[model samples]
Target chain A: MLHIVNKSPAERNALESCLRVAQGGAILLIEDGVYAATRGNAAENHLRDALSRFKVYALAPDLEARGMGDRVMEGVATVDYGGFVDLVAEHKNCQSWL
Target chain B: MSEGTIKKFMFVNRKAPYGTIYALESLEVVLITAAFDQDVSLVFLDDGVFQLKKGQQTKGIENKNFSPTYRALDGYDIEKLYVEAESLAARGLTEDDLLVDVTVMSRAELGKLMDEMDVVLSF
Candidate 1:
């Protein structure tokens, strides 16, 4: 599994690159990525299809801070600090998108 | 052994996109390395989170806001995303305000994750 941490638009391309290699993977949203949760956002739609049945997660803390926790799209789970470590253990590799 | 090893690669985005080329240029490298079949992931922290915001107008700045490009990323197969929890709290940003889905790890945890990676690239 692989993890992507995109906080910028330029970094999104990197996330796109990772989708090509994703076999068993997970996508986590934190920091600025929380903005993707907005209604009709294009990035959110793209991420949904890119993961393709793979696990997708986001940070609740970030969501709440930005006042978007309740607005996050469904299907993607939210992970906490401990869950973050679990992701590291679960995935063979991790990369930063930004 | 080194040549065949499929080490996990991670990207840490520390700055907002647009003003500096580091984030955008670093993104290009991410795609290039993925084409090489490297396992990759991404993290957003500090001002880096600003890259994913919505409704940004770059007209006045004479630059194109790159946030919309994030939607096209799925076409390239790059979707694994992450963020730094403390950073978000410090910045007063929430998942709802972000542009994508990702995991929020603590600073210590994020650092530890990097230690476990075969490759760690930050922009």
Candidate 2:
């Protein structure tokens, strides 16, 4: 399964909730959810914890929009909209934690 | 994605419309995915039930009302739309309150249906 989080961890607890149920899958951060990739943000530790259990990805356009390209955590892959479609194709299911 | 590559695609809608763009964007993707000829179904739970509410007045907000689009979904051959019964009851909504026809099911039934999907996308 692919888990997508489009909410900022600061404003919503969806990210935390998503991580708890995610056993082994891919995580994609889109929209305002890209803030999770910003280094030293409030959710950095949780994002780091997710890295060990699942492959993490942040939408490239979203990161660039927030000017967070340089600050994204290491090991987290960056992908475009095309990549988003590909991720959906690769995974058996996608759970968007809105 | 290709001809005859049909897969069971489930879209789990859990957000209300207008307050945010999630519901609208999610609908857009559903339309696009349907064009690919995939077997698609939509499950409306929680605030997502609001998406199907009749007589949504978006003119006050200066937004083109898209609620009517749900009525045309069947023309696209995308007809497997389900609403969680408990969610509707919690919101004090009945099938008569919605604009389109949908199968109302229990949470357990919906969960089992979800497990049968090849892909599940939510908003």
Candidate 3:
């Protein structure tokens, strides 16, 4: 399964809610949701914990747009738009945590 | 626009850049306001503070890196940039991480400053 989250954890609970229910799948963080994958953010610990259960990915463009491309935490992979499409196609099932 | 017509304009940015259009839209509007010689001040809080962080490279995302425009604000006479102390701390960022020179104030102090604005716009 692939879980997509686009909202900021500081501003919304979409990421938190997704983490609670999602099990053993890949999580792609895009848009404001990319904030969760950065270093020093309050949600860093939660994302770190989720890493054990899922392969977390963040949109490269979104992180760069926020000027945080270099600050992404360790263990999380970054993907471009093409990679995003691939993730959607690779997964038999996907969920967007809008 | 006469000298007496200049108004205090405050643009409150709460969204992270590029997550949505809010941050960019607010910046554009702020530039437009500066052209009118309005007394413009930008307040960055919450994720909005991320807009001011340095080293924003957007080539990979293929979006115009608008973060550089923030540095150009001073040339436009838009120099009053305020950041919330709590917001930076929450994100583990300090003033050193910001691209522009701004006054960092507590939320309470910011609120009082906001009260003095003739107009306040939230993004």
* Fnat across every predicted model, in order: 0.29, 0.47, 0.00
Best by TM-score: 2
Q: What is the TM-score of chain A in candidate 1?
A: 0.76
The 10 consecutive residues of candidate 2 chain B with the worst lDDT sum are B107-116
Candidate 1 chain A, which ten residues in sequence have the lowest lDDT sum? A15-24
lDDT (C-alpha) at residue B86 in model 2 = 78
Return the candidate ranking by TM-score, descending: 2, 3, 1
The TM-score of candidate 1 is 0.52
TM-score versus the correct structure, for each prediction: 0.52, 0.62, 0.56
- Candidate 1 lDDT, tens digit per residue, B5-120? 67677777878877788777777887787776677777777777887766678899898666766666666677777777766777788878877667777765665666577877
lDDT at residue B113 of model 1 (Cα atoms)? 64
CAPRI verdict (incorrect, acceptable, medium, high) for model 1: incorrect
lDDT of 3 by residue, A1-51 (tens): 677889999989678756754456799999999999999999999999989
What is the per-residue lDDT of model 2 for residues B24-73, given as tens digits with 9 covering 90 to 100? Answer: 88889999999998999998887899999998999889977889889989
Model 3: lDDT of residue A58: 99
TM-score of 3: 0.56
Between prediction 1 and prediction 3, which has the larger DockQ? 1
